[model samples]
Structures are given as structure tokens and as C-alpha cells.
Target chain A: MTPRPQQEPTCHGEDYAPFERALLNDYQHELPLVPRPFAAIGEQLGVSEQAVLEALQRFREQGVLSRVGATLKPGAVGAATLAAMGIPERDLEQVAAIVSARPEVNHNYEREHELNLWFVAMAADDAALRAALTAIENETGYPLLDLRLVCDYHLDLGFDIQWTSANETDA
Target chain B: MDVSERDRRLIGALQAGLPLVRRPYAVIGEAVDMSESEVLRRIAALRDAGVIRRFGVIVRHHELGYRANAMMVWAVPEHQVDSLGERVAESPQVTLCYRRRPAPPQWPYNLYCMVHGRDRETVLAVRDELVARHGLEGMEHRVLFSGRRFKQRGARYLAPKQEAIGREANHGRA
Candidate 1:
């Protein structure tokens, strides 16, 4: 694993307007799935598909847009599992290497606390997801706090939810 | 930059359904009253705009017996967060890894990650190992698993034809 940079550019301050946030949050739904989807989106917004393209491109660069692809449900076609672990501040960098090295895990992030490292594993089946998780724990020695979703509601964590219009009369 | 009505219509069709045919573009064209080649060009344009990320299948997890799933949040030391963030992302079980800015005193954790699993036991087992290996015994964390799935849909964004919403006005309640 590479060494952690002394610091990362915080995704704060005036990163975007409420419009971009709303757009990022709901951009996927706006995407036209037709042959010429881009033009279709343009038609809806009264903007050229080119504008939508440019805006989305800018969003991607800003980290507000994770990806525009289909966010298919997990464990559907193949398999997936939720896993987490507490990483001591000192050893986090080293442990992250072990966790991220697995081919099954897709997304990972950092949070505050002892169980610092969190990630997910997708596989062809439940067994594979488990085996992979077990292997990760065994190798890393960090316990995984795996929480399986019995039910999901509005699981779409749209980053656009952050959008708050300045025009809101209350504000 | 501005988008047009035709583009919205096109996205609506695809979000509704990616025509399952040899020439899906041609089928979409027929529905919206456009030529297949024209549909294809428009789609390319949307791809450039980042509106349509990918043309892929929408899958269901429970149907395949992945009955359980959860969002696992972890607190890694600020220094080690990034490296660890990348490592956990490599796991297939882990999806949607990110480092959200946590709120004040109560949540000092600078790191947050997620994982999906078939059941609780499986998730716990995986969690334990991560704790031990990452040497995360000293931090605080939480696991907010999804209790129910209320609404999940393909892109519901359709720039209204009549109302012109400024960039800031666009939003959906989660």
C-alpha cells in the first residue's frame, strides 16, 4: 500500500450550488437510457445534451458523482456482504492495504472511531463472500463487524440529498 | 449549459427500460419517433454529459439469496484513513466506500466504509477479522443496517418540460 498523504483536499467549502447537488442526487434518474440518451436528457432540461455532459463531467471531477452507471442491487446476480473493522489510528494505513487488496471489495471509506475500516465484498455466492471476509479478518487480525441488511428503504444514498436551495423562503 | 426536451424523453425511455433487442437503439428510436442512428448519437452525447453512466442490467440481491445487507461505518485514524480506505474498497463484498465528514465531539471518526452480506453471522465474522487485523481495537464505530427498502428506482430525473428549475432547485427527498 502506498503511504497516506499528509492530508487530502477536504470536500468542503463552496464545492457546488444546490442545483449541482440536486442534479448529482437525481442525475441517474434523469439519464436517458435510449440510443441517444444524452440528447434526451437535454430535451428534458431545455439544455443541450452537451450541457448535461459538461455538468456531469464537472461533478465527477469533484467527487460528488461516484459513477453514473447502473447501481445494481447487491447479492442479486452474484453475491455481496457488508463488513467493517476497528483500526487503531497507528496501524490503519497498513491494515487498509490488506483490506483493499481483495478483488471482491468494491467501495471503501474512512470514518471516526476504533472500528475505523469499513468495506463490502461482492461474490458469485454467499459462500464466496464469507470466505473472502474470513480470509480478510484472518490475515488482518482485525475483527469485522459485518451487518447484513434484512430490509432496505431508500438505500439510494444520493449525494444530491445535500442540496439545499438558497431560494428557500425559510432560509 | 442547457439540456433539451428530447434528451429528457430519451433518458426516460431508457430508465424505464433498455429495449431488449438486437438494436435497442432502433427500438428506443421507434418509441420516441426518431431514427435508430439518431438515438445512438443522442445516447453517445448523454454518455459524454455523465447523465447515463452505463448501459447495464438492473439486478436484485434477495432473488439470489443475498438476503442480508448492512452499512458498516468505521473510524480510522486520520493519518491511516486514506490508505485503509483504498484497501477496503478492493473487496467485492464492500461497495460504496467513502470518507464522509463526521459531525463534532460525538463522532470523531474521519473514516466511513460499507459492506453487504447474506446474513448477520456472516457479517459479524467478517467484522471481527477486520478489527483484529487492522488493529482497530482502539476506535469507535457503528453499523446502521438497512431495515427495509422502501423505494428504489432507476433514474427518476426528468427535467420538467414546462417548469424551468434553476440548478439549485433540483432535488428528491432521498
Candidate 2:
């Protein structure tokens, strides 16, 4: 593989070493399934296996990498829904905490809109997913809007973090 | 393809993450009481079955400096949704594109795509480009920028036991 030209480190208040950039960009998908996966990654990046392992550990500690694991297809094993609720501005934080506390609510975010608190709840099945939504409604005292998925158009292969220089103007 | 009891246990064990080590599969095998080769075979079988969509590093985009995250929703006509969805998914700017049932009266937009950039302007620019290129201007749409991510983690699967363990360790947020 040809070495990428060393572009100027252009990021929004974040500086990633070249090795970190490679790990973030190249190895997001197609990780070798072997006894010594890190060794395989080391061979590709031309570094020792130990170096790869230590870098991954540091990335975990710094919250840069979520994990090196499987991203199961949505509804592959269970049911999930994108649920939202409108909370009074004063109680947004409190209501968010209540919603986020649920183990089934994997993603909870505050968006800019009337129905601000949005989250994705996954359960063992459709019945369990509905139960989780109902419980959230009861706990938060706010009506929950359950938006079930109709179709998925993209296969999530992870993001490409190597931004071109054209995107640097906004930075 | 039917899943065996052992496969379910293996999926439950892997839902959280693979242990970072020289022999992570061996470590997992010990927990699930399977040999290292058995564990590898089961994982491969699961992947082949499309149960595992992706297996690799999961990065936190916000921390990586793609901070301007916007969720764009459009109310496309029913006849055009299928083709338009495929087209929208082709744009490099759109990371996630999907269709969800729209709540009527209050919410009528169905098509959704997410764009992340270094700043809010960049994200909006991408959205505008898509709108113009796709002739989506006449369609009613809304751009919801994500704020204050209270919680984000890997999708917990299989058993409630795995979820219970995940609840204790849900500190990373973007």
C-alpha cells in the first residue's frame, strides 16, 4: 500500500498521531478474525503487535474508540425503535437522565426541536420493545413518540474520518 | 439458519465488546466455556449468517472532531421514496440514511439522513447540496442538530444479563 501523503493535521481542536489516524480510518472494518488479530493489524501497519494492542488500550482510555467488536444488524436478533419525547426546558436534563438510565436505551440524545429527547431502545422482541417505551412514558410523565423503522438504506461500515483539505475552510 | 443455545451465549458475550488482548477469543471462550477454536467457528458462522453486520473498531465521531452532527428529515412522496433513498445513501456526506414511519399531523417527514462535519455550516452546506441535487426543495423537511448526547453505547443483545452488565459501564458519551 502506498503511504498517504502527510497532509497537515486539520481537525477541530483534536490532534491525532499518524498511527492513530490509520487505525481510525483504515481498520474501522474488515478486522482479521484470527487468534492474534492485533498481530495481523501490526503487520499491515508495519509495527509490533504489542504496539497495536497498547494503542487500542490508550484509545479506549481516551474515549476515542468505543470498542473493537461486532455491530449487529438492527432487528437482527431483537426489536428496536427510535423514540422521542417533548420535555419542558426546565426538566430536559432530569427527564433525559430518567430515559438514559434504562439499560435498553442504548442511544439518548437531546436534539433541537419541540420533541427534543430522542433515543433508540432495543429489546429481546417487539413486545419487550413496546414495554420499554411504555415504561419510559410512565416514568417521565411525557408522551413518547415511537417511530419504528420502515426501511434501512445503508450498510453501516463505519465513518471515513480522513477529511480532505476542502473541508478545512469551515474549521 | 437456526441458532443453537451455545451460539446465543456467544452472541451475548460478544455484544459488549471483545476483550483487548493477544488472545481475546481465548479469554471469551473461557467465560463461555468453549474452546478457542469453537469460539472462532461460532463467530464465523454468525458472521456468515448476517447476524453480525460489522466486526471492527468503533470510533467516537465527536471526539474525532466531526462535531457538527445534523439529522435531516424529508417528506418524500411514496412513489419516489425507494429510489430516492438509494440515491441519498450514495452521497459520501450522508453517513446514515433510512426510512422510518412518520407521525402524522405533528411529524410528517419520513426519510432521514445524518451528516457530520467539523462545523454547523459545513453540515448545513452538505444538506443544501443534497436538497438542490435531488430537487428536494419543495418537500417539507427539518434539520435536527444533535445536542448533549446523554448516552451512547454498543447495542446490547441476546440476554437481559448482558444488558445488566452494560448498564454498570455506560460512561462513554459523545
Candidate 3:
């Protein structure tokens, strides 16, 4: 691997209000199951309901928060697999688009490896999921390395962020 | 628990997002023609039944300064997967750790864990620490760093049928 230049950090400390930090770190999981969920969050943070809503909305606009909803358990309602394909560098973009065009593909990422194009194919059931993967293989002309999850130890992707002193500003 | 038509519709509605409002349940209820209390009841019931895993803010790690992320796969003996997976999951740096069925002939890794950090160097240092601490120096492993994210979104389980219909309609147009 070649040495890469360090890139400047995108998120700054002043970007996070005290409440916003709490929302990102504390509320990553286990949102209150209430009629007015935002209101509950506000009460806990000592902020107004409107303020909570606005902050969340702003976060979404800024790409901080992807959504405010449930993180479904994998393979709970359907079937999925981590699949990879090795496409020549020249055909990478074309093959990636073909794979990404499928609605069953919720995640398609190019990674650094011989088998570079990695994606997760999700479907309503096992049969549908298999069909989707098969279709991708037929279309791409590249054999796929299909990896099915056998067991999960910890699948939570959410994590806390530590704001750096350089980025810190009075909230 | 069996998810009925009503529950499917509710899940579809909430899949994209919950309305950012004071009375989000009420807004969601209005969409499905259910009363606010009923929406609350069903959601709570679904949660208890494990149909809904968790309801919360979905933070984008990259936006939060976690620029370096790698999916580390290891070819561990089948017998050692469970114990090793547990240990890997216990690490704070590892957000996701699981045992997967490796594809033979081409792929031969069964254990997977996702490590995230502020930079590539940080992630590599943590990966080294994990390997040393877990005593997995002899295991065959590969680290794949994500390059371009082509697509990413919440799972669309209930909307598949609708999406299929939509696809057909678009096909006809083409």
C-alpha cells in the first residue's frame, strides 16, 4: 500500500452544539418509544421540542444523521449476503453501476483488494436473495464471492465521536 | 411474531424516516389511518415482539470524522470463531463483528469485524493492537478499506413488492 497524505478533518468542534453532541453520542440507539419522541429527547436535554427537531433536521441536511428510525436486525425480515466481484480497473465503473442499479443492493462499495466490488444484496426471502445474486453474476460476467453470515457477535455500527481540542469552540 | 399487512405498511412508512415533529406518532398514524394511540401501541408491541430492533438516530460515521473504516476478515478455525468473535466484538474500536460462511475456491475468510478510526494510520494501529491482544498473529486475514460508496440506505423489506411494480412500469416506459 502506498503512503497517503493526511486529509483535514471534516467535522469541527464548533459544528456540534452541546445538545447535538448528546444526540449523536447518547441517542444513537434506544430512542424513546413515545408519541412525541422529539419532545422526550428535548426534556432530557433541557432543550425545546422545536430545537430538538431543528437540530436533527440540520444534522440530516449536513449528513450527520442518516435518518431517525429503527435499525432492523439483519436477516430478520429477509435474506442478505456480503458479495464481492473482481472487475478489471477499466470496467470497474460500468460494473459498479450495474450492481448499484438493483434495488436489492442497499450497499455497494468499492474496496481495495483483488475482489474489489463489494455489495450487500438484500431481498424479501432466501429465494429472492439468491435470484438477485445470480442475476448480478450473469450480468457482470465476473464470478462473485458470496459470504453468508453465520452468526453475529456485535453488529451495531453506531459509535461515539470525540471532538478534538483544535475544533472546539464555545457552544 | 407475524407482521400483518398493517405492520408492513407501518414499517414501510417508517423505513425512510420518522417525521421530525412534536407529534411524530400522530403524523405516522395519519398516514396509515390509525389513531395516534394505536400507532404508539403497535410500535411498542412490535418492539417488544422483536420485530423492530431499535428506533433512534442513525449517525453517518464519515460525517462524524470517522474517515478510516476497514472490514477485516480472518480465516479462523470453525471451532474458534465463536470465542474469537466475542472477543473482537468486545473491542470498542470494532463496531461490527460476526462469523460468516466463507466461499471456498476463491474466498477463505469466515470471521469479519469492522474497525473505524479518525484516519488510516489510527485504524491500522488499532488493528495491530487487536491482533496482538487477541493472540491471532498466526491467522490468515485481509484488510479491505472502503473506497467509494455507490449506494447506501435503510433496508427496504416491505417496499420490495412496490419496487418491483415500479420497475415494471419503468421498463414499459423504456
Cα displacement (angstroms), candidate 3, residue B16, comes to 1.1
Evaluation by DockQ, superior candidate among 1 and 3: 3
In model 3, what is the error at residue B65, expressed in angstroms? 1.3
Give each prediction's DockQ, rounded to 2 decimals: 0.04, 0.61, 0.59
**Which candidate's DockQ is highest?**
2
Ranking by TM-score: 2, 3, 1
Per-residue lDDT of candidate 3, residues B18-59 (tens digit): 767677767766666788898888888887787777778887
Residue B171, model 1: Cα distance from true site in angstroms: 29
Model 1 lDDT at residue A113:
43
Checking candidate 3 for backbone clashes, the offending pairs are: none
RMSD of each: 17.6, 5.2, 6.4
- Candidate 3, what DockQ? 0.59
- Candidate 2, residue A60: CA error in Å? 1.2
Candidate 3 C-alpha lDDT tens digits along A86-149? 9999999999999999888978989999999999888877988888898998998888888898
Give the TM-score, chain B only, in order for the candidates. 0.66, 0.87, 0.84
| Positional deviation of residue A62's Cα in model 2 after best superposition, in angstroms | 1.4
